[model samples]
Target: MSDDLKVTAELRESFGKGAARKLRALGKIPAVLYGHGTEPVHVSLPGHQMLLILRKSNAVLELDIDGKGQLALVKDVQKDPVRQIIEHIDLIVVRKGEKVTIDVPIHLEGEAAPGTTVNQDSNTISLEALATAIPESVVVSIEGAEDGTQIFAKDLILPEGSSLITDEDTLIVAISIAQEQDLGEETDEAPAEEAAPAAE
Candidate 1:
């Protein structure tokens, strides 16, 4: 949960849609940082650098503003539907050893029994982990698993200090036999030729 990402942000005085658009034109992302009963601070972050840091799941950020370091987590991100560019971002300030609940992706390992298909009911599980050490993903093994086998959330072996926040009975993965698709028979019907007598 180390804040591997460090970036500098500038205070943004302007507000509203027009201002946000102008910032995007300059390759800056408008963002708000607020948490722990603190006032929301508006700022502009470097678009390219933020994009690269966000490639990882649950990215933790160490923001250096005016020589003051603040630890934060990405809470929400708004993006343009068509352009797929960052529109606005919302961040929550956090501190060391703080427990936060976040969704961690499930990684499937190995193959299930032959002729059987692995049906994953849930791809991510909710975990209560330290803000600085949140897991990137959890791996579940289905190797040699037989049909009708189901894995539940409670059965997951969590990382060192993380705990499952999702319901224990939640179905994570289900191994079942694959159903074969059958195509309907094709018709051989063809259009009849017009009679030449009509021309007479």
Candidate 2:
């Protein structure tokens, strides 16, 4: 993890919806941290800074909780449905070199063979990797792949230390022939009298 991901948080003493709304109004986000059989600690984080850091997936935060240092992983986020506002966040404690299981997004590197339609069945894959060294995403290349070609989860090439946690048989991508759309030219050529008789 980079030092840019580090954040200084304040231990929150208040709880409940009203307190949370007040915190948000003050440009702070309400959050809870827990793991390793420890009691959950409620904290308030800088909203703008956290928003920027969370743009990347699986963000690991090196936190300063009232002068005490702790490492935590972004576990889950709750947002407002209409406004997309960050309502709350859940953090799980982690240590350096600890292996954590998380889903990594899949990125396609190249285009398939011309005229072939590419169908992506899975958008992300599960991986078990060191918490501090988690990869941002897994790349799968389809350059020059022909129609009827299929790529499965087992075929993915992962980062050096990461291991696949998803089932091996899961389909990732499938390439097939693209179907042409009908232009309705045939319907225009039919006689009006014949079409009326068929409708009756």
Taken over the whole model, the C-alpha lDDT of each candidate is 0.89, 0.94
What are the clashing pairs of model 1? Answer: 1-132, 1-133
lDDT of 1 by residue, 117-192 (tens): 8999999999999998988899999999999999999998899889989999999999988765322122222212
RMSD of each candidate relative to the true structure: 6.2, 2.7
Measured with C-alpha atoms, the lDDT of residue 2 in candidate 1 is 45
Clashing residue pairs in candidate 2 (N, C-alpha, C atoms within 3 angstroms): none
State the displacement of the C-alpha of residue 168, model 2, in Å, after optimal TM-score superposition.
0.3
For candidate 2, write residues 39-156 as lDDT tens digits: 9999999999999999999988999998999999999999999999999999999999899999999999999999999999999999999998889999999999999999999999
Off by over 4 Å in 1: 1-4, 181-200
Of candidate 1, the 10-residue stretch with the lowest lDDT total is 183-192
